[model samples]
Target: MRKVWVGILMFWAGLAQAEEVVIAALGDSLTQGFGLTQAEGFVPQLETWIQSRDASVRLINAGVSGDTTAGGLARVAWTLQPEVDGLIVALGGNDLLRGIDPNEVRKNMEGIMRAAQTAQVPVLLIGMQASNNFGTEYKADFDRVFPELAKSYDAAFLPSFFAGLSDGEGPQDPAALRQWFQADGIHPNADGVSLIVEAVGPKLEGLIAKIDAVGE
Candidate 1:
């Protein structure tokens, strides 16, 4: 009876550990939790959101401030380590800010996706849009890179990382959006991080489901 009970305990423990998923969040300062407390940053907040949904998951922050898609591509191999079960690719903001060529961004993103594919890890591609200041043609081209790549790679897609922050009635009103950002007006504040987490949480859950389905 004692040996049987020990075996049952070990099995349950293994099952619990199996439920814990390790997700690597690969991106820019936003993923790094810039301008926010460590506990309030994107990774931590995202983890909290995941736990709230009763999912056992962990997020590894591989974000570098001002990193472009090329940068992300360069680090894909190392970031997607042996224990990494999935990836969250949230790059391209710096590429947009620097007005880098959309085709180049697309290629770089494709490379990153391919790297993830080779590792047999699922990906969640988070997209960003170019501001109007970059002009209509640039905006259109930049906007298409994400969804196109996501479709081609069969990755999960989050159209805009900052989707729920505005109601569309006053997008241009900095005052209305001010509360969502820090003084730099670029990286989100803690409140903004919460909103972003809420918006992306469901999609993340879907990605987790994919990972579980694949037995990763």
Candidate 2:
């Protein structure tokens, strides 16, 4: 009876541990929560959002300010550690800002995905739209990379990280769009972070489902 009770306790403990999922968010300044407090950053806000929905998950902020796809690629292998259950690849804005070749961005992104795949972890790729400063042809090329990579890798995809923040009311209504952004018109403020968390929360739930399924 004593031995049987010990076995039961051990099993339950293991099961409890299995229920706790860890996810890594790999990206640039947006993911890093630039110009925001630690609590106000994307990762913490996202954690709050996920926990509010009753998910037993932890998110690691692997975001670096000004990191391009190549920079993300360089560190992906180390980022997908043994205990990490899933990955969120949110990169390429810097690449667009710097006008790096779209093809090169695609290659670096592919490397990151392959690294995650090789580690046997699931991935969620977040897309970024180019600003008009980059021109139509460049914008088109840069915008296509995320969905293409997501489809190719069979990873989950979120079309744009800033989805709900931009209402199509046009630049005439700066307040609608500007309200969510910081002074630089780039990084999101605390409220902007909340909006992003709300927009991507559903997709994150889907990714969490995948992680749970894999664990099972």
- Candidate with the greatest TM-score versus the true structure: 1
TM-score of each: 0.92, 0.90
Name model 2 segments beyond 4 Å from true. Answer: 1-14, 167-175
Clashes of 2: 0
- Each prediction's whole-model lDDT (CA): 0.90, 0.87
lDDT of 1 by residue, 20-113 (tens): 8999999999999987889999999999999988888989999999899999999999999988999999998889888999999999999999
TM-score of 2: 0.90
lDDT (10s digit) by residue, model 2, range 9-127? 99999998877889999999999999999999999999999999888899999999999999999999889888899999999888988899888998999999999888889998889
